[model samples]
Target: MMDVGRHPNIKLLAYSEIESISGYIGNFHVRVRKKARYVDETQCTACGECAKVCPVAVPDEYQLGLSLRKAIYIPFAQAVPSAYLIDMKACLGTNPIACGKCAEKCDKKCINYDMQDEIIEFDAGVVIVATGMDVYDPTELEEYGYTRYENVITSMEFERLISAGGPSDGHFIRPSDKRRPKTVGFIQCVGSRSERRGKPYCSNICCMNTVKDTLLLKDHYPDVEAKVFYIDIRAFGKGFEDLFKRSKEAGVQYIRGIPGEIIEDPVTKNLKVMVEDTTTNRISEHELDMIVLSVGVTPRADMPEVQQLLTLSKTPDGFFMEAHPKLKPVDAPTSGVFFAGCAEAPKDVKDSVTQASAAASRAMTVLSAGKIKLEAITSVINPEICRFCTICAQACPYKAIKVEPKKKSIELIEAMCKGCGTCGAECRFGAIKMRHFTDEQTYAQIDAYLEEDPYNKIIVFACNWCSYAGADTCGGARLQYPPSARLIRTMCSGRVDEDWVLYAFRKGAPIVVVSGCHFVDCHYIDANRWTQKRVEKLWDKLEKLGIRPDRLFLEWISAAEGQRFAKTMIDIERHRQRVTKEEIEYTMKVLSEQK
Candidate 1:
């Protein structure tokens, strides 16, 4: 990152937060709040003379609060800019007027207490999000005894203890008495792969990290006993399995079970871990001087803030969602914004670096072109037909519809619009229209299906990726279903708006079924969840309007579930037969008049 920061083409802007983002992909106007660093980067030489004279000391976050740092100090040894930054929160001038010795001792006089935050605006052709991840806190799992026992420490704290510049100067010692330990226990998956406390996804680095830490211990202390408790050793990467094997060959004991509890010894301040070996079917207890909890990685705490800022969608696990996991892994649903590293999902260091490189290449592909070609399926607003009600603006999920209050007109940004037709469906005045799937195209399909045998037909709106594919799978498998069904495919279930559902009823269709991917496994991230919510609202409205809610159904059918899809359609057809022609006619008349 420091090397990239030194690139002449890339003007590095540090200590900045994005305040606002406007416009669309190719010509985005971004406003950034450049926070004050209070030191001149160009003038200061990163010498340690100023830091030595500073009296104010605070816990160093880079060392995981295991060490102290001067008020005016560098973040770390390899920190970019290689310059001192004043800790305004800890500095005497900002907190209180107790001391100003650091400012007085600086030879270059770079310290400035009066600097204020400045806002700057810039045009970006592309944006890459690589905010990375945070370690899960094990304090909530009280059974681990993390907060109570000084011998129990997280993997991050252990990393610092093994580093040369760490608090104890790379000496592995017990936190209670600073004595060398003969036995250490590594507990794997402390907050991973468990639905009870933390996330369910496998944190990709924990297994390898434990292996690396065990190797580090063996290098420093040859006779020290190291044991690792894991459900299964996941060493899938290149040379990773070799490292795992090497650790075992070097006499590190591998246990096949996570410890249930860690009890502290009263006399020696050691830890006694209780575990049941699944292979041997035996419960065992081990005494260890130090216990390192191999914590899992989770999405950043401010992920929701970033999601709103970029208008990006998130998966059920709260990590940023990719446009397509296999096809467009780095790209976000919003075209220009891309994801890298653990921000997308849990990944190892090698995967992170690979993804970072891929993200850089993807961003360069957009910026190097100097212009972007938008998809043909974007939304369009007709100025002459627009009523200027601003309903489209309110309904658009991507904020693609822009209304000019001064002109009293609405404009659709082609780059930002996803062609979901949600705005067109919500617009009461029929002002907005999607390009490929326009109102006329949709109505034509409905007219074709319902023009003949309208009262007996069952209308099904299936999403392209999942439900539609499921229908194909049913046909390929020769699954038996009713022939009275008519299908219309959309890009996603979210595209099946409320007006469309009501419109099907108005066309004399006895039953209307909206189907898509299952929740959390949506092709468009959480789009299916929105579809679920809309269907529920429609059911409520039907019940309130004295219409039978059973006439409408919402089902989640994955592409692999051919038998289930065939059974669902057959079952719905059986129910549709219960509605007589007179009841269908009466319902259609009432719905049409109401619309």
Candidate 2:
């Protein structure tokens, strides 16, 4: 932390929060709130004088409330900047002449009760999000008796109690009696893999952390008994299994089952644990001096704020969703933004460092050239055809389009545009044109395909990233599909303009299938979502125009689902067979009349 503070290129804004974020990848505008610390960071030498004179005291959050600290105190011992920050909530305002003892005693005269929060605005080429994580609170479990019992504590509190700099001064003692615990019981997966109470996902660090804690116990107090109860140990990391073995060799009893109930003695405060030892195949009870709940980590409570600010997506586990799970692990769907540390998932120290370095490297690669190279496949707008309704801008997934109200024009940043063609698809006026995949080119393909056996053929629009690749996978595997299926490849499902689908129907097509990547796995952020919306509107249009809505099909196919692709094509062939020549003619007549 000290080294980072002194680094030449690193400007450490120690106590700052991101207030707002705007603009796209290369030119991002950021507003940060540098919270008032009261003491000037450059002037204060982190002397203990201010803390000594301060009357207001509060529980130190760093120690998990195991110790008390004055209102005017450093956040932690190894905190960067090494400056004291006054808690405005705890410190009575000096304007009303409340407690002003700390301000007077400050030899550096850096105390300023009137200090206000400063908003700093800056532009950056890239940004990294390492918002970190929060630990699960086991108090709500109630059965663990966390708040109900004095001897029961979470794993974090246990760390502080065992630390040399802790309030207990390196004495590992029970909270109830303040005596060294002879027998300690560690409960694993306290707030993880529980469908009813907590998150159902496995916390990556819990099992290994418990093992290390047990090793620490045996090292410090050789005679101290340490018992761990868990479903199973996960030591998949390099040398992690060896550490688990060492802990077991040091006499850490690893049980197979979790405790069903923990009952504390009313007088001694020793916990009575009732658990089924799977290995022994018998229910047993054990008395322990202290109970430690090996708590799990969770996404930060303020994660939704970051998600909203960046317009980023999240996975089922609530972590920030990467661009691609396997290919672009550290990259955000919103380009230029990268995730590191616990912000992505519950990772250990080593894994977090690895991801942080990777994110930094990715950011550096983007800014190294000083100029962004845009893709040839981008959207173009016709000023003459544009009605300035702003529908295209509203439908754009990337927010790449800029609409000028006074100028009555739309400006698109080519570098920012991902070439998804969602804006073009949503433009009712036909003002926008996707550069390479223009309306004329797509229409020409549809016309040529429908020119021969339009009634017997099935028209399929596939996204390049997934569905198109799935079709190629079918070909590579020699999987059988209907010979009548004519595929139209687009950059994204969003590129399948409604005009093409209608034109195919107007030419007497039997079946039109719109297939793309699964809703969550779109290559162009949320471009597939625009595809979904457009398909729904087209379905309504078809239904109102006396055409069967079922004739317009929507499917989400991934690159790995080649078998499903072939099967879907067969099903489309079967559906096509059901449509008679008369029905096709009627559909074509209805669509042509509507057009």
Candidate 3:
């Protein structure tokens, strides 16, 4: 961090936040708001003179509030710029200029009470998101008595107490009495893998972190008893299993059960924990001098704002979703944007470093190229035929289409397009065309499928990334389904133009199904949202025409759901068999009348 701050080419803007981001991949313009520090970075030195005379003091956030710091202080020991800064919220010099003792004491005269926030702007070719994660607060679980018991602390607080710069000055002590604890209890998964109170996903590092903590405790005091209570220890990483073994050999007890309750002793300030041993089917109670909650990680509280700024997608767990989990883990779905560290998911230091390197390499590749190469398969609009209703623009998840309502014109920016074909499907006037998956080509595929047995055939339009891949997975699994369900692939479910569905229905098709990725998990951000709207519109039209709305089905299918694909196919075929010849003829007559 210090090296990056001093690097000639790198302009490290500390204490700044991005206000807005605009433009495309290679031409991104960003506006930033830099908060005032009340101390000039270039003029101020790393002397602690100002902090010594400051009257105001507050909880140090870097130490998780385990220690107190002066109002005018650096965030941490090795903070970049290595300069003293005032916290306006904690200082008395703000608004009324109540206290100027720090300014008087400062030999360099770097303090400035009149400093204001500065707005800065810059252009970049690529952007990397490395906003780290936050630890889950376990105070919500009242059963653990985390708030009531003074000795019950989180893993982070434990780190601060043990550090040389901590309030304890490198001496491990109980928060209640500042005495070295003879027995300590480490509770794993305090805020992880619990559908009731916490998230469903594993915290990825809690198990190994507990192991390290136990080893560290035993090393400091050989006679001290250390115990870890967990549902199960997942030491799957390299050398992680060995570390767990070492902790056990070093006299750390491993218990396979999460404590159900904790009660503190008023006299001794110790905690009595109750837990059921699943292995022996017996309940046990243990008393310990101190308890440590091995808290899990959570996505940053401001993740939604960051995701919106970059037009990025997020997983159901609230972490930023990668472009592709396997192929493009570091890349965001939006071009020229990449992810690193726990911003993407709950990852350990090793994995975060790996992803950071990958993201940096990807950014380097994008910036090194003088010009970007856009995909040939992008949206094209015919202005003469366009209604300029802005439906295409609204449907585009990437905001690739610009609407000029006054001129009745629509412009498609090919550079920003991912070729999801959402705009093409939403364009009711048939003015927008998806380059490769044009209406003519799609209609031909539909016509070819219905040529043999139109009334018995079940036509399916499957999205290329999800539903089509699901079919391939079904085939690989050798899952058997009725042959009547014929699939036609498109770049996205939004690519399934209503014309293609009407043409199939007019040819006496018994059923037409359109499938894509789940609403939240769309490969092209919210492309599946447009798919839902289009399908709903088609259902409304079919009902008005006196055709059965049930005949047109819209299903959400992902690549991992092979069984769902096969089951859906079988269900569609069964429904096709129940459709009578007269109903098919009626549907065909109604669809044909519309033309």
Candidate 1 per-residue lDDT over residues 1-595, each given as its tens digit: 6887789887777778888887777777899998887887777899878789887899999998888998888998888778888888877764456566767777898878888899999998888898889999999999998979998999999999988888899988878999989999999998999999988988989999999999999988999999999999999989999999999999999999988889998889989988999999898999999999999999999988888888888887878989878888999988788888999999987898898899889988998888887777767788888888887777676788889767887778877877666677666677777777776787889989999988789999998888999999999999988998899988778778788888888889899999998875576545566677789999999887777999999999988888999999999998899988887888788887797
Off by over 4 Å in 1: 94-98, 405-407, 519-534, 592-595
TM-score, per-candidate, Cα-based? 0.95, 0.95, 0.97
Candidate 1 overall Cα lDDT vs. reference? 0.86
Residue pairs with backbone atoms closer than 3 Å in model 2 (clashes): none
Clashes of each: 0, 0, 0
Report the backbone clash tally of model 3: 0
Q: What is the lDDT of candidate 2?
A: 0.89
Residues 412-462 of candidate 2 have per-residue lDDT tens digits of 878678899999998889889999899999899989998977888889999
The window of 10 residues in a row where model 2 has the poorest summed lDDT is 90-99
Please say which candidate is ahead in TM-score: 1 or 3.
Answer: 3
RMSD of each: 2.1, 2.0, 1.6
lDDT score, candidate 1, position 367: 82
The lDDT-based order of candidates, best leading, equals: 3, 2, 1
